[model samples]
Each structure stands twice: as structure tokens, then as C-alpha cells.
Target: MNKVIIDEDIVLKGEHLSIVFGGLKAVEDFNIEIKKGELVGLIGPNGAGKTTAFNLLTGVYKPTSGNIYLNGTNVSRLSPHKRVAKGIARTFQNIRLFKKLSVLDNVKIACNSNMKYSPLTAIFRLPNFWKEEKELDRKAKDILAVFGLNEVEEEYAVNLPYGKQRKLEIARAIATDPKIILLDEPAAGMNPTETEELMETIKIVKEKYDVSILLIEHDMKLVMGICERIIVLNYGKIIASGIPEEIQSNKTVITAYLGEEVE
Candidate 1:
């Protein structure tokens, strides 16, 4: 992939990104650019390489070929935590939380990279350690409030309901103070009411945090309702991309989902 100058408005860009696992090409030539504060959706039939593409972007899996740029810097080789520090944050398709930790602690942990106190200060509980801890506590609670999780801030994460657990995971990602967030199927397993609530929550997150979002969701209603633009993938490649209305009418996308050729 040739290097291209990134626009200031582009928070994240992936260029000709491809990944091969063993003998299989999971994702090939996937390219995307997410603008500041934009909400974009990625949709495809199962096993269409959506998650693989996300992994490549978030540094969970390094691309076999191509480059990932944050702002204008090449971050294709950065580790997952390094990527997070550099303004990329992601949540898994499955909820991965510290089951035993309180909801507040879970969010505070994501903010660890931002803490300035030295290890010695923390080990001895110095004045600066308490000062930073107090600030993080206030910050975590504020984030939890956005998700309607403030009331449960002291509860263990494993005790929250399925929907609340999903919310908590998102809240934790936001705690990283990211430039962009990649959400993997945030609506999976949610009932209609929960899904609706989730849609609103996502909107609030974007507006309140000023963060760009790239969402992977199977729920067409949620996608069409909130996403400004949509990208459709089939057989590990993007087949169509445009505004939601254009994607809804695309012949290639229709065929990919229904498994029948369209005239």
C-alpha cells in the first residue's frame, strides 16, 4: 500500500488492508476512512470478514499487507494497548469485562494510561496518588452517568443485566478518551427494546464524547436508523459503500445477504 497524506478531518484511515490466516484470506484489500464525529456502519453476512477487518484496524491482529494510519501516522505495527493510547479504542463482539470488578473500577482501569502518578507514588499511597485517584473516580462516575450506569457504579460488572453489561463495555471504551471507537456488534443478543435503547445510547456517546464510531451490527433497523453511511462486505471484500439509502438499494448487497442473484 502506498502512503497517502491523511486529511485533518480523517480520524482513522486503513489503506489496502489485507490479512491471510494460514491458507485462507480472511480480509482482502479493505480500505476505510472515518471522519471526525461521523458514525459509520459495517454490515455483511456472517463470516464476511467484518471482525477480521476490525482486528486489523485495532492492532488485535496485524495485517499481512497494507497500512493503518491514525491521523497521519502509520500505526500498522502498533500493539493493541499502543493503539488505544494513540486514540483507537474497541469493544469485542462478546462482552469482555472484569467480571469481579465494580463497574466504576472497570472504567477507571481503561484510564490507566492517562494517570500521571509514578508506581512508587501508588505503592506508598502518596498525596499525588490520592489526588489522581480522586479525579479518576469523578471521571468514571461521569462516564457511567452517560450510560445510566451511575446508580450501579459500585456493583460488580458480572451482576449487571445483559443490556447493562453491554452499556458498561461501551462506557469503558469511552473512558480511554479515544478519537475513534470501533464497536463490534453492540446490539447482538439484545431484545427489541434493549436494541432501541442501545441505539440512543450510541448517539449520546458520539455527541457527548465527540468521537467517531465504526459499528458492526446485524440489526438493519438500527443501522439504517443511525448510520450516516454504510459499507457492505462479501467474501472478505467490500462490494458496496454509500449513504444508507444507496446501500439498501444496491444489487450486490441484496444478493450477498439473500444468497440469490439480482437482476
Candidate 2:
């Protein structure tokens, strides 16, 4: 009956998080704490509730029971938009981009959420609105440049290679200026070469943007390489929580992946 004890320096903390869908429990007694500036991984087999947890955190689905806190503020009741304003943003496992929009415009659209200019002023083309728009354009461009996407800024997102499209998703998430980013399978469909490049890009994003990340990835190699800590889930609950090496050697994690060793 021993439970995993979390460290106290928690930036994003969830307590007894559970989600029940019509008498079926999708997530049960789930808990996690993401410390400031820490890059952590959430790993699990299919149906382990990794994506479900992300949905609860981002307000896509409300938890049936639990508390979600961000930077010491209770955020369980906040709407998705309000959560973004409170510094939480996430990218989906599937690529979701404005396919018709240029790369720069996609990034710019994310920035619009934080823009201070009033719509009335923008519609009227006021001097103040113009100034704010200029500032936002500059900031969006700077963020795109960090991801090495400035070169393709004017190109349509649908035309970019698969890897660049993934990068653009990350860039858009960052453009929201979130303190915590949830990346769900950032390297899902990439070749090894693309994954390697993406690994580097993820590291760069962490350092340059000064944001903590919670990654949900199935690629063991990528997860082991970049994550400072790893949380393994099975059957909608955490089975093992430790550093990469510890996770690699954990008996519970091994059994979860390989099934219990037959007697």
C-alpha cells in the first residue's frame, strides 16, 4: 500500500485526480507534480490515461474529482482560455495547425490571445492598436526565429515538411507565453533523423523559453534521452516514478511493459 511521495518544490500539482465517464473510470487517483523548469516525461502503455490527464490539465475535460494547482493558484475551475492566461498551454498528439495560414500567421494567431489592444481600436486602426500590433509581430517573429522557422515564415503550414509542421505546433504553443507546456507525442510520426533533430529543438525550446515541459511520448529512446524525471502509468494509475535510469531498472515498470514474468 505504499504510495509515491512527491517532492515539495512543485509548480504544477494535482491531488487525487480522477475522471469517471458514465460509471467507467478513465483516470483514478492520479497525481503528479511538475517542478519549475523541469522537463519531465509521462509514459504509459495504451489506455494508461496519459492523454486524459493532459485533457484535464488543459480544461478540455473537467475532472470528476481532484484539485489542479498552478504556481500556487487553484485552477481546477478555470476555463481553457483562462488556463492559458494562467500559463498553461498544450499541443495535441495529432498535428493541429492552421493549414491555410502562413507559418508566421500561425504563430501570430497564438499571440493574439495575449494581445492588449481592443478589437474596436484594431478595427478603427488606431495609433495605439498599430503600436501593439507591431510589437506582437516582432515578438512572434522572434519566437519563430528561435525554432529556426523564420526561414519558412511566409510559407503555408500545409506545405512544410512533417517535422517542420511539428516544430510549428511547438512554436505556436510557446507563442502563448505559457509557463508550463504539455507536449503530447511531439515525435510521433518522424524518422530517426527527424526525431534526433526534434530532440535538439525541444532542448533548445526549454532553454530559450524558460518553460517547464511535461512530455507524453511513446518513443522510449526520446523519453529516456531528454527527460530529467519519468512517470510511468499503467491502468490509469502511476506504477513507477523516478529518474530515467531508475525507471529503466524498475521492476514494476518492466512488468508493465513486458507483462509479469511467468513463474
Candidate 3:
């Protein structure tokens, strides 16, 4: 039970967060803070409650206890859609895309969450609706170009390569224009080269958009290379949290990963 010093410039804060399903406790006494514009990593072995914690933060599931705050505002009561509108967006561990929709359209759909036009106006093709539609399309195209997916703008999402699909998912999330983005295993199924490219893309995205990132990655190399800070979870609770060098040498973290007490 080593105590790790947490910084105070937190943009997203979880206070005593916990979640339970029936009689099984998934996450307990979870507390973490993500600083503004910082790239942080959340890592642990499978079933460590990493994804469950993610669900609580993103409003996919209500917390059984504790609270979540974004920019000092209590957002625990907000719905998923409202959370997105309030500058929080997330990508799934499994890629979720509309297979029949083109890459451009998939990204466009993310932007539609905040669309200004009413359904009646859009259905009737009113002048204001048409104007807003055009603007949305233009913005979506711009986002695709930023991700180097403009070439495949017309290609169906299901037709893209696996790595490209991953990138497209990120592009779609970014299209929502959120201040904080949660990415679950962004480099899960990529080769070294593709992972390297994704690392660069992530860095560029954070710098250019000024967005804070919370990443869950099992790839040690990728996590150590990209994340400024790392939090390690085990058995539904945080065991260690620190910078890369500190985490590498931490006794509790080493034991958690290696399955034996560190001397």
C-alpha cells in the first residue's frame, strides 16, 4: 500500500468512485485526477476494473458510490449524450462504427450530436437546415483531412484496414470536439509501425486540439513512451500511480504485474 503523490491541476476528478453489479463489487474507492492537457495512462491485468471505471466516468453506468466532476462541475448525473456535449468523448475498446456508412459519414454522425437544425427543418430541406448541413459536412471533411483519411472519405468503414479503422474511430471521437477524450486501448491490435504512427497522431491531436487524454493500454512500450503519467489498477482498486520511471521502479506495481512481492 504505497502512497503516490497526486498532482492538483486536475481537469477530471473522481472522488471515492465505486460500482457494483448485484453482489459483485467491480470498482471500489477509485480516485484519480486528470490534469488539463496531460496524457495519462491507466493500466492493469485483465478484469482489473479498468473498463468498468471507464463506464462510470463516461456515464454508461451510474456509480454505486462517489462522484465524478469535470472542470469542477458535478457531472455524475449527466447522461452519456449530455456528457459528450459537455466536452467529454470516448472511443471503445472494440471498434464501434457503422459498417455500411462511409468513413466521412461516420465522422459526420459524431458531429450531428450537436447539430443546430431541427428534424422538421431537415426533412423539409429548409434554407437554415441546408446551410447547417453544409457547414457540418465541411467540418467533418476538415477533421478527416487532419487524420489523413480524406482519401477514404467515400469508402465504407467496414472496408477499411484494421489499423485504418482504429484511426477512423479516433477521428470520429475527435469530431465531437470534446475537451477530454478517453481512449480504451488505442493500440490494441496494431503492429509496431502502426503503433508508432498512432503514438505520433495522439501527440499531435493533444497538442493541436488542446485536449486532455486518459488512455488504457496494455502495451507497455506504447504506454511508457507516450503517457506522461501512469495509474496502475489491480483487483478493482488503484495500486500504483506515477511517472514512467517511478512506475517502472515501484515495488507494488512490479508485484502487481509479476505476481510476487518485490524485495
Candidate 4:
């Protein structure tokens, strides 16, 4: 993987983002600024509101107070689909996919949103529909190849082993042509070997797609190994932020998650 040059251009910004549910504050005073091609990680123990932060940025939940800016435009109130149109795409922690669908079909569905054909054209199997379908098929195959998933294009998503399934989810996310992709717990439930493979895949994804990535992951080795910058969250708040080496020895981050600081 080529080394990522963290640029000064900010693509996504969340300023003072906070959300409250009844008496609980799921996230508070959250601020993150991501450069156009940087890969950042969000790490914390479970229920620390790491996913909640993702939700706020992706418009799954309106910030009770604060603002979200994408490419210098305020997108705090835009709908999720609108955000997707603005180059924000994400994969779920739970490995959400069309279980019965072939891997190629899964990616083509993402491409369909960009197709110019009308509903009537699609229903009638018109020329435009066929034209767009062919292009989408090629695009899907290309991205699948980028993720090393092309060989399994005809396989059902549910039939993929756990790690390949994660790769497929990311491929689907990138197929939407996002400028910034949010990945939620991409290393969840993987063994050591699989996690290592995933870390490399993420670097490849960044290079192939040329997109910024903000991920939520608990695997310390994966997070510390791959992320250019790491943000530590605890109880819905960011407690630490820095490069991996700094994070490795930070007392607060260690206390929050690792029980003790590393030597």
C-alpha cells in the first residue's frame, strides 16, 4: 500500500455535534475534521457512542445541537440519501447485505442510483435500461476486482466467509463513489489473520478509491496499525486523538480501554 499523504483540505467536519436521548447523552461536543484522502479511526469500548457519532455525521440522527459540514457546505439537516449524493457512504457494523443476492448484484444496486433511466424505462426493459445496466455491470466488476472480490461475483453474499463478507460490504460502499466513507467496526468478529488482511484491504481501498475513510473499530492492532490518526472515545466523548505511536502510550486512552499504558 502506498503511504497516504494527509492533506490539509478538510472534506468532512462535525463541530460541537451532540445528541441526547432522554437523560442520556449519546454524544456530546464531538468534533472531527477529515482531510480528503486521510484514513482515521474511531476507537472505544462498546456503547461508547462511536456508532452514534457515525449516525450523526451520516444524518441517521439529527444532532440535538451543533452542525455538520461536508466540503464546506452545511449538511446537518440533509437526509441520508442526500448525504450519499454529496459523497458520504457507509457500511454497517452488523454486515448488512442482501444475503440471497450475488455479490455482483449487490454492487450493481448501488450503481443503479446513478443510472439515468426512468422507472418506466426499467419496467419496459428499454434501451436506456440495458445501456445503463451494462455500464453498471462493468463498474461493479471493476470495484469488486479492486477489493479482490471479483472471483466470487456470482456467489451469494451470505455464503461468503466472515472476512470476505466485510470486504464485500466495503466494496459496496465504495461503489457509490463516496468522497468519504464511514466504516463501522469493520474488524469485528475476525481472527488475527483475517484482521491483518482487513487492515491491508482498507489501505488498498483508500488507494483505489482515492477517498477519505473514518472508521469505528475495536481491534486495537488493526486500528493502531492502519489508521493515520486515531480518536479515542469513551462514554460518548472523545478523550484522545493523535497518531498511533502517541496513542499507544497515552495514559488516558490506556486507562479508558487498555487498563494500563503500554511500555
TM-score sort, best first:
1, 2, 3, 4
Alpha-carbon TM-score of each model against the true structure: 0.97, 0.94, 0.93, 0.93
**C-alpha lDDT of residue 155 in model 4:** 97
Candidate 2 structure lDDT: 0.90
In angstroms, how far off is 139's CA in candidate 1?
0.3
The number of the candidate with the highest lDDT is 1
24-70: candidate 3 lDDT, tens digit per residue = 78899999889899999999978889999999999999999988887
* Model 4 pairs whose backbones collide: none
Error of 4 at 134 (Å): 0.7
Instruction: Summarize candidate 1's per-residue lDDT along 1-263 as a digit string, tens digits.
Output: 43457698999999999989898989999999999999999999999999999999999898989999998788987898988998999999999999999999999998877999999999999999999999999999999999999999999999999999999999999999999999999989999999999999999999999999999999877899999999988888999999999999999898888893331
**Candidate 3 has what TM-score?**
0.93
lDDT string for model 2 (26-104, tens) is: 8889888899899999998877889999999888999999988877778898899998998999999999999999999
In lDDT terms, how accurate is model 4?
Answer: 0.89
* lDDT of every model, 2 decimals: 0.93, 0.90, 0.89, 0.89
Off by over 4 Å in 2: 1-9, 260-263
Candidate 1 residue spans exceeding 4 A from truth: 1-4, 260-263
